[model samples]
Target: MTEAAACGIDGVDTGLADPPLLVADGVTRWYGHRLGCRDVSFRLWPGEVLGIVGESGSGKTTLLDCLSGRLTPSDGTVTYRTAGGETVDIFSRPEAERRLLQRTEWGIVRQNPRDGLRMGVSAGANIGERLMAAGGRHYGRIRALAGEWLERVEIDHDRLDDRPTTFSGGMQQRLQIARNLVTHPRLVFMDEPTGSLDVSVQARLLDLLRGLVARFGLAAVIVTHDLAVARLLAHRLMVMQQGAVVESGLTDQVLDDPQHPYTQLLVSSVLQA
Candidate 1:
C-alpha cells in the first residue's frame, strides 16, 4: 500500500514525521496449506490502541502471535522501535534478544489468565518475577512495587501472599495484568483479555484496562471477537475476515459507517443481537 493509504487507514495525518512503535509489513502466517493470516500490514503509534476484531477462525489470534514474536510468519516482517529509538525486525533478532525484549519492553496478556500468570506462585511473586527479570534486585523494593500493582489492579494488597489459583477468574485475570504491567512495558499484546469473564466482571476489568492503558500511555494491539470490547479500549479498529483486513479506520468511524460488506455485517450483527 502507498504511504497515503497507510496514513488514511489509521485516520491520522502523521505525515511520517514520527516513527511508529510497531510496524507489521505484509505479515503472513500459514499452516501448511491452511492460511492463518494473509498480508496483514499496519502501523501502531506510541500510546495508541489498535483492536483487531474478527470471529473465530478469522485469524486475528494468528496475526497477533506473529506480531508478538510468539510465532514466525511464513512471509513479511514485524519490526519494532525500541525504547531507545532503535528499530529492529523482531524475527531477525536472536532468540535470546527476542526473549529479552519480551521480558523487558513488551507484555503479552493471554485470553486465559492461567496462561499468563504463575499459578503456583504467590500474587506478589508473579508481579515481582517480571521486575526481577528487568534487573530489579532489592527485595523490599520488589515486594513493595508488587503490592502497589496489586492495588492498582483493584486486588487487595492483603492477598499478596495468596496463589492465583485461589482467586476468582476475574481476580486471576487482574493479577495477570498486574504482573505484566509491573515491568512498565511500552507495548502490550492482549488476546481477548476479558473474553472468559462474566459480564459484570468483564465491565469492571474493561474499565480497569482502559484506565491502565491510558495512564501508562501504552501502545497495544488487542484481538477480540466482541466489538464492544474494541469500541471501549481501541482508538482504531481493524476488521479482519477470512484472514485479511477488510477495513480499518478510527474506531467510531469504522463501527458507525463501515465500508466493507464484512464490516457492515459485523456491525449489523452486533446491533441486532
Candidate 2:
C-alpha cells in the first residue's frame, strides 16, 4: 500500500490507531463550589457506547461538558487523540485546535431541543451548520447531507426548509439528532436526548438511535435519568450517584443483578413491556 493509503480508512484518513477518542483522567467540573465527578477517569473508544445514569444533580451533564471541551476540568486532563495519532490534552490545546475539534468532530445533543438547536433556523440549516463548520459550504453538498441525515433520523426530508417551531417535541428531538449526526462525528455526547418526548415517541427515537449508532459505528456517552434509556442504548452502564461512579459493568449484568444499592434502586424502577 502507498504511504497515504496506509494512513487512511479506505482512503478516508481516520486516525484510530492510537489514542482513545476521548479520555478523562481525574477530570472534575465545578458548579458554584459544588464538585462534579471528583477525580473521574474513563476512556471512550471508537464504536463503543458508555451510558452514564444518575439522578438529577449526580454530575452526568458536568462530565459530558468536560469531555466535549465546553468546560475545562478543575483538576484533570481531557485528551483528544488526532486522526494522525497525535495526542493533545484538550484543556491544554491551543485555542485554534480546540475550536476545530469542538466545531468539526464533536457532537453534543441536549435534553431540551431548544437549548441545542437554533429555533429560528430551518431544520435543514440546523443540520447543515455543522457541515459548514467542517468546511462544507457549497449549497448542494450541505443540502444533500442534511437531507440524508433528516431521513436517517426518520424526519421527513420535505420539511427541510421548515423552521423548528412547526415541529412537536418529538419531531424537534429527532431533528436535533439529525443535526448532530449529520457531522459524522466519531464520539457523540447526548444528555437526555429523549427526555422531552412522549413514551411512544421515545421508543421510536430510541430504536432509530440504536440503528444509526450501529450503522455509523460511533462511540457515545449518553446521560439519562431513565433507567430504560440506559438499558436500551448502552453496551456498558456506569451508575453514578453524588458525582461518582458506584457500579459499572455490561449493561445486562448491571441491570439484571445490580449489586450497588443505588443501581438496584435504579434498575427496580424499570417496568417490563
Candidate 3:
C-alpha cells in the first residue's frame, strides 16, 4: 500500500470512518552517537492491542517511549488524533500540550511498579489522583471511582486506603493499571505489565488485562521480552532486533510461523527454555 493509504491520511475520515488513534512515522530515538532505534513506524487502531517484543536492549522500551511521546524522538514524528477529531504531532506540541494528552487521552503503565505507581500514596489515592488530574476532583466521586477501578482490577475495596508499600508486587501493579484505566483513555502503553509478578500472579493479571482491554475498548501498545506475554495479549506483534523491527504480523502468524531468523530465534528461545 502507498504511504498515504497506510497512514489513512488522505481525507479518509469521511465522518463515518474510524480514524487511527495514533501514528508514528519514521520515529527514532538515540543516545549520543548510538542509535537506540531508527526508521521505526507503526499505527494503532482503537480497541486493538499491538505487542512489541524483543530481547532486552532491542529497544522495545525506547520505541514505546518515543511513540507515546514520553521520549522525544531524535528523528521523525509521533502523531495522535484526539477523539475530538483534532490531529497533532505530539512531539511537536509544547510541554503543556503533551501534558494535556497525558492527563486525558493517553495512559502509560511502566515496567517497574514503583516507577508506574505512587509508592508513597494509599491505593485509593493513587487511582483517585489520576481521576483528579483528569479533572475529576469530587471526593465522593473520586472515592467511588477509585473503588470501582479497584474492583475492576479485582483489588479488595476494603484496603483502598492502605499504601502501596503494604501491597504485594502484583497488587501494586494492579493499582497502577487501575490508575491508568480510570481515565478511560483511547490508548494505553504498557511496558512489561506482568514482568515482576510470579507465575500465578502473572496469570491472574494477564487474564485481567485481556479482559480489561476488551472491556474498555482501549487501543494499546504493550512492550515485553516474554513472547508468551505477547501471545496472550496481542492481536498484532512487532518484533525488533538491534533496534529495528525485523517483522510484524498477526500475533499467531508471527509466533507460529516466524519468517525472520531473529523471530525464529525468539520463538526457539521460548520453546527451548
Tell me how many residue pairs clash in candidate 3.
Answer: 0
- Candidate 3 has a TM-score of 0.93
TM-score of 1: 0.96
Candidate 1 segments exceeding 4 Å error? 1-3, 6-15, 271-273
Name the lDDT value of residue 65 in candidate 1: 96
Across 1-273, the per-residue lDDT of candidate 1 in tens digits comes to 434556665566656788899999999999999999999998899999999998999999999999999999999999999999999999999999999999999999999999999889999999999999999999999999999999999999999999998999999999999998999999999999999999999999999999999999999999999999999999999999999999889999999999999999889898543
Q: Give the per-residue lDDT of model 3 (tens digit) for 1-273.
A: 223454456765534246678888888888998889878887777888999999999999999988887899889888899978998999778999898898789899998889988888899999988889889968998999899889989999998999999999999999999999999988999999999899899999999999989888899999999988999999999999989998998899999999999999889877543
lDDT of 2 at 188: 84
TM-score of each: 0.96, 0.89, 0.93
| Stronger candidate by TM-score (1 vs 2) | 1
Error of 1 at 91 (Å): 0.4
Q: For model 3, what is the C-alpha lDDT against the true structure?
A: 0.89
- Give the candidates in order of TM-score, highest first: 1, 3, 2
> Candidate 1 at 56: error in angstroms?
0.5
Q: List the RMSD of every prediction in angstroms.
A: 2.4, 7.4, 3.3
